[model samples]
Target: MGAPVSVTCLSAPVSVTCLSAPVSVTCLSAPVSVTCLSAPVSVTCLSAPVSVTCLSAPVSVTCLSAPVSVTCLSAPVSVTCLSAPVSVTCLSAPVSVTCLSALVSVTCLSAPVSVTRLSAPVSVTRLSAPVSVTCFSAPVSVTCLSAPVSVTCLSAPVSVTCFSAPVSVTCLSAPVSVTCLSAPVSVTCFSAPVSVTRLSAPVSVTCLSAPVSVTCFSAPVSVTCLSALVSVTCLSAPVSVTCLSAPVSVKCLSAPVSVTCLSAPVSVTCFSAPVSVTCLSAPVSVTCLSAPVSVTCLSAPVSVTCFSAPVSVTCFSAPVSVTRLSAPVSVTCLSAPSLSDVSLSPSVSDVIISLEVLASLGMDIQPG
Candidate 1:
């Protein structure tokens, strides 16, 4: 065992803390089976904000690949660096990142300089030499479920892109494309990219060159309601929507309609099941009123097609607001408003009349 080296990194604007200690302790000078001895150490600021780098013995402790964003941070903290038999604390002057020992490292990759978050190319040069770290960008999170925690996920991107010519690092449209270009120093995985989308359009939708690139993530071609009176549930991941819920009752382009168990400790069964709830539509779109229940016009004359099971709509606001529903739309049910008596407003009178007229002619009034 040898006396480990120490280094500290101050917050940005404050240049890196170098291991400038002149104290020299030669590891070779020790006797046979010699006890730990201090070695001459040199700390360099590979980059600002990053405090110290013990050049003597490569102190490879676990590092955070994902930006550890602590919203509840009370004060500035220190990120300590460690070597076997001894540990070093690199103080990042009253800054937030307090790296507690939460992970382990298997290998250390060096290019004179290190970097992270490569969406576009941003380069760095260290060790009195120049090197390149071409990093790729992903649209979503990649999970290495079985691997260690050293996995690389570019929350955003920067690159050591300065070169003689343009070096193109393919930016993946999806998380699955994050394969090692050459070789990775180490890898880790948490939760992989889960497929979530609106029946109409999905947010956080990745940039893809092909359709159904990942079929698991594809939005349903269409949803239909087979019954006028139906009960729909809401579900998220790993919950099958096909089961226990009607189709198309869950309209896309609506509100933040998501699937959740009618009750707590909800047990999920199939893939599309329980029920799917997501705020799909926009301001001019149909907004979900309740849990797979009611909906109203966000603006005027909005059309909404349900995606879940048998469901109905009961207008709560401006009953006579919506004008011409050009797109095929469905009528929702009143929440627990027993059908004792209900009447369409004068504004909605023509809508119901014309629809009935079209129904007689077998004309489609809603988006199928």
Candidate 2:
């Protein structure tokens, strides 16, 4: 309403772009981008990337160091990435990102953008509109084609593609791909090949210095890796995964799932149900449907199942088997040669088996 205020900022090897009608703008410490179109906008990207874009609306955006990628279209969105690699994309909206030596990318369309140190390369692209792209590293390329997008790459190479729903990608030293269909999607990859494709709503995939893969079709999907060779896939569901070692796989379809693999070689599968699986050593597997199941294994192989009820199975040492049928079941097996077969229908029971207790009861339990 006051003849559209215009401001430009600079911080050496940093770029700040501001266009169209503006109300107020400021950039401190590093290079930043701000675009205000016939509205009042305030943006601060401290150590992260905070981008705010609004049409005839007031917006405020801020970001810290947490690898937080939030993409909101047609409104105001706030995000923070703290000491981690995170990406956020918003079309006609507001988004933020923060990093400490972490990879990050933030993109906005017809909105105000603020990006900080980044430490990695930052790219923003667009067409027939105001598009801003900035890179902060040597030998880094920032590319934006058709409709104002932002892409950031690290010491290596990073690529991103978005159509209609605003996509964001951040890579520390690996490759990440995100495909969004009518929703906000964020994909962050660190030293691995991570792919998130074909979703109907908000979903996030994160990989950290591990060989990991995650795929989601709908709902909220989250995959975080601190290990090697981890895989997760979900369709119209929420999948939470945490890995600390090699070879962990999780698959879910229209269900609520939680998996934590601290050791190696763990697998889980679920359909239209809730399942919780935790593996401590090598080799643990869980497959369930329409029930609440928990399987915990330490230093050996273990298997468990529950249908229409609650089940918990814990194992220690080698070659232990515990099976329960149709009830509230609990099996605690320690130091095999021990086997338990329980069938307690519609009741509450606890069965404890130890090799030392079996030997005390005049039964010979061989320890292999």
Candidate 3:
């Protein structure tokens, strides 16, 4: 008996058996059941339901306002500023858990688990698992009502926020940036290089086989078959990209990139740079390539097909179809009333139309 045992305003059931001395248990709002073995334990301002067990010294737990459950074996465990639903388990030392606003679950078997600034709804699992995991400023807010978050095998750098339940991220090989406002997010087997930003839900990214760099932003995004050697960039939503089987480089600045190529070799670049590309659909057969294709402020509809390459179309207002021009083909229609179907086949070398699209092509211009 080294003389220091203070249990203030107790209701019932309090046990303290110290062999070497130094044990201070303070309960301000009562309802306490405290047990300390083998000295050195400090617990302060506990509202209700506190269980502290320290074997072989050095355990400090502070400020548990409501609903707290802590269990530490073999010392060295520090838990700070917990509001509600906290369950901490430390088997063999080295665990620092910080400022959990509400609902947190932490477990460290062999040490090294750092969870930082989580604002409600959290579940972390590590079984000999922690080779650099850094997650910063996870924002899930809209009254914060949708919950179900899982992060598995995170090999450093994870930033997540998906509102409206249903977020699953698996095997993130590193470099993952995700942002979805209306929920419904699924990213699977990403071998580094994944950047997703969608505002209105309905996002599905599957089996990104490797060598990945995907950038998507808004308007009902659906990207499928991101095999390998992938680089996709979509800006203004209303997007449907399918089966981009290897060697894909697509860049759409003001929305309207519908490129369908089945036999590989694709490089589609549309940049009005200032918002006014209603539609640019490149429908390929064997070879339909545009090296220098530019449409400055086309309202709608400009379909071009070149067998040997080089087809240039510029339309200020709708409907101009140029077919199978061998090489060096140019069709310019400014405020087209009606080009009335311009068809030129026989290895078209050079054709230029500017006189208001050749007087609206009154005779259905057919020169082969």
Candidate 4:
């Protein structure tokens, strides 16, 4: 019923070895009828008809778009599906399923399994055993009600459960965890820890609930949280934070750290650790960390956290940004000062510069 299919390897060395009793020998392929043995066997068919039956043997099977029906009676197996739909039914066998850009459905009875699917929906139902499932870009629903299970879903939602074993689920949206007689863990919504338990374990948990740190400099309004620690550095500008529940530390040249705090302390340092701001009703600790810098505080009882070496600002009105200057100092002004207004020290020498004889000779001065 599907499109044209290619089966690359199938060998039937001996003709029909038909027996009512279960055979346990490796067998090859025929165009329409291919049966294998109890020993693990590999079969490849190129544009061959799809009838492959293996009795009591583990198998590695690959088919391109032709409905592949492989029944592994009792053994472990691995299946990979690409671009086409594949349905694998394993009876009392441990299985590993990988689906890439295709829809895959797997049903296993009394087996432990691990399934990884990318870009498509993969539904796996395992009755018992430890299960690990990871899905990317699409939804993955797994129901394994026997052993420990861990599921990670990225950019999509996931629903997973383990009855008598622990279940771990991490997804983009709200993830639900239901278990009895076992511990359960869930992480959802931007690295936020969410825990669910009816009576024993905590019913709900959300951590790093808000953006940890946000910084914007010379660009459009941007906000980002660096989880656990919040540090913002702005140039000579204005920075405002709505609610900062964590310890707020700021070190800037001339910028102001204005914050309305509901729960935590605000610390600001400026200059060499110059500008320090302490605000709201919370107790604050401040450290002047900069040198040769200007400091402006807008609150009371300012404390220093830590300070480096001594720093001095020699010139402020001219906006001179040098900590130390070397001699000899040369001075030039937009408007020249009068000779009497200029005072020369003992180290200064006055040389009489004259060009009278060259002007008398009618020679013009030009920069070569």
Best by lDDT: 2
Clashing residue pairs in candidate 3, if any? none
Task: Tell me the tens digit of each residue's lDDT in model 1 across 1-368.
Answer: 23343424343232222233332211211111111112332322322212223333222222222211111111222233221111122212122112222221111122222223234222222212222232344222222212221223344221211212111222332232222111121111122222222221111212222121111122222211111111222233121221122212332222233332111111111222222332222122223322232333221222333233222333322122222222222354222133222233223423333343344334478864
Model 1 clash tally? 70
TM-score of 3: 0.36
Instruction: Return whichever of 2 and 3 wins on TM-score.
Output: 2
Per-residue C-alpha lDDT of model 2 across residues 92-165, encoded as one tens digit per residue: 75443334455656565555554554455555443223333333441233333334334455644545555444
**On a 0 to 100 scale, what is the lDDT of residue 309 in model 1?**
28
Candidate 3: which stretches are off by over 4 Å? 1-46, 49-300, 303-318, 321-337, 340-368
Worst 10 residues of 2 by lDDT: 126-135
Task: Quote each prediction's TM-score.
Answer: 0.25, 0.37, 0.36, 0.46
The residue-by-residue lDDT of candidate 4 on 11-102, one tens digit each, is 54332232233322222343444465454544433333344456666656554443445666676766654555656677788877776776
Per-residue lDDT, model 3, residue 101, is 73
How many pairs of residues collide in each model? Answer: 70, 19, 0, 27
Ten contiguous residues with the weakest lDDT in model 1 = 28-37
Question: Can you rank all candidates by TM-score, best first?
Answer: 4, 2, 3, 1
> What ranking of all candidate models by lDDT puts the best one first?
2, 3, 4, 1
In the order shown, what is each candidate's alpha-carbon RMSD?
17.6, 14.2, 13.2, 19.3
